[model samples]
Target: MSVMIILIIVSLFVASGFLVAFIWAVKSGQFDDASTPSYRMLWDDATTQKKINKQSSNHKQKSNGN
Candidate 1:
């Protein structure tokens, strides 16, 4: 039907728009650090913070209890 043909054309136009935007983003370095975020998150920042906090709290408790 004519309606189906028009729908297909409209869908293609929208998909191409998205494709162009994706290409533009890639060229602009938007995807440059895509892998780094995944790996960086695997490095536990909380552990280091907790260690520092524990040391500081221990020092404070020792200082105040004396």
Candidate 2:
């Protein structure tokens, strides 16, 4: 049927679009750091808190001196 042929063409276009997007992601280094993300969450909180504390202490010191 003509409807079936149209459906096949539409499906092929959708499949090719997905393939192009996947290839672009591979070329763009999207998957290059796969392992880092799993480990980052474990250490990010501690490092972020340390940075915040350091900045706050520096601000307090400058305010007290003035």
Question: Which candidate leads in lDDT?
Answer: 2
Model 1 lDDT per residue over 1-66, tens place: 999999999999999999999999999999887688877765668777889999999999999999
lDDT of 1 at 65: 100
Local distance difference test scores for all models = 0.92, 0.96
What's the alpha carbon RMSD for model 1?
3.2
Provide backbone clash counts, one per model: 0, 0
My TM-score estimates for the predictions, one after another, are 0.65, 0.68
Error of 2 at 24 (Å): 0.9
Q: Which candidate is the best by TM-score?
A: 2
